[model samples]
Target: MKGIIGKKIGMTSVFDPGGKQIACTIIEAGPCVVTQVKTEATDGYNALQIAYGDKKEKHTIAAEKNHFVKANTAAKKFVKEFRNYSEEKNIGDTITVDIFAEGEKVDVVGITKGKGFQGVVKRHGFSGVGEGSHGQHDRQRAPGSIGGSSYPSRVFKGMRMAGRMGTDRVKVKGLKIVKVFADKNYILVSGSVPGHNGSIVLIQK
Candidate 1:
């Protein structure tokens, strides 16, 4: 798969050629410079590490600074690798949003927003035992009757319960490429993708 690193700018609505309004996620992608090219002989794998975004030199670390020096470029805030390509490329090569065209399909991977310590009502979508009309006072939102009185000795292993939620790596597949603005280094993808605005996302074609 051919992959690129992008930042989610925000969501916007654009009119298609047929005058239909399309909801799209705008991503500022690319103008990424290749930092290193790993070969099977040296690294036991083939990959190209691309770097993008300028970072403040005062806040940059020594190791990352060395990476930029090797590529003869400024320090970037993001660096990612794309592996196993059919074609060969060299270091310092730039890959922009121009690689993707309108109406193409791509897969996006990112971390979802965190919703900490959710209940069964929001987490697992449980009905939670309703009102207290049947002499049930405090048990308004409870997963009633987890098991019987004298049946299994313990709860089921894969039973759904309320605990932590969200803040996980998620991938949405087959998102249509609604539009591509190469000059602006932006691409519009249809449907919701994981993560919040300015979050880094991996796009694969």
Candidate 2:
């Protein structure tokens, strides 16, 4: 399988051949240039490093600047490797949405939006204590009795507690490729993906 670095341009509903509106997440795919190729004999593994999007010189580090120079291109804002694709690709080669076509299936991976510091009710989906109709008082949102009264009084090591949520690498598998507009350098997959709008996502097939 190969992967493409892309930015989630947002989502929209588009009519399929069946004429039914299908929910799709539009992503600005490549125009990605191959920056490097790592062979197994030399690098111990095969991979193709691809660069996408432009980054200013001020924000580019020296090592990365030198890397882009080898390709005769500016440092990209994002760069990633498609493992095992090195043998077939070369530096300075470009890939685009043409790699994908309509009616295909792909896997999308990205970091989800962070919802800072959430409670057990939201994180663990715990139903608050006490019967709602009874004398619940302020115990409605409380996590009543974390453990047994006498036996094993200490809280369990893996007990779920209130903490940060989201902002984790999430992979959505088996998303249908509803549309591929190569002329526009974008593709649309049927259904949702991780991360908010404009967040970078990796699509693999």
Candidate 3:
């Protein structure tokens, strides 16, 4: 799979090697900018479209300014793809963070940090409905019994109640690569990685 397209740049701690501290998360990744290269007898499969940050050719338009001028690279701002791409990229190729190293184990897609209208005790840890004198004033955090007084009467479709929580799209599997600056393209990653401080992440592998 192989991937790259980051921005997080926040947490920190380091110290491992028997010292034990670890924490990580810094990101930044990619010198990215491959721009196209699809092919599989002409776009039937094989991906690799890359692109990252640096966007503003008057907000860019005209077919994305002729699709980044056939990869000559300029107006970016994230444009992922990467399918079946295990190297063999072309069309202004770049891909950085030294393609990942340190200890390996990537996989971080992101977008989870909106928390707009949360409920059910911080969006889903629940633990509400009980406590607070025998009277149960506000019924604690309420989310109690959504529906049911007539056999499938309603409310039962992935029924986790409580409306919109985070921005969704999370992925975060594995994670470990604690450090790999590549002369400051940054990398760090080892713990928390959803979106928040600087957002935009991908990092697959």
Which one is best on TM-score? 2
> How many pairs of residues collide in model 2?
0
Per-residue error at 67 for model 1, in Å?
A: 1.9
lDDT, ranked from best to worst: 2, 1, 3
> Which is the winner by lDDT between candidate 2 and candidate 3?
2
| Model 1 bad stretches (over 4 Å) | 145-158
The global Cα lDDT (0 to 1) of model 3 is 0.86
lDDT of 1 by residue, 8-125 (tens): 9999988877999988999998888889999999999998888888899999999988988988899999888888854566777788897888888999999998899988888888
Error of 3 at 191 (Å): 18
Question: What residue pairs clash in candidate 2, if any at all?
Answer: none
Model 1 gets an lDDT of 0.88
Q: How do the residues 66-176 of candidate 2 rate in per-residue lDDT, one tens digit apiece?
A: 999988888899899888762377788888888887788899999999999998888889988867677667777777777876888788888888899999999999999
lDDT of 3 by residue, 74-171 (tens): 88988989899887979988889887788889889899888777787888889998888988788888888988888878887797877888898989
TM-score-better candidate, 2 vs 3: 2
Model 2 segments more than 4 A misplaced: 132-135, 148-153
**TM-scores for every candidate against the unseen true structure:** 0.89, 0.93, 0.36
Worst 10 residues of 1 by lDDT: 85-94
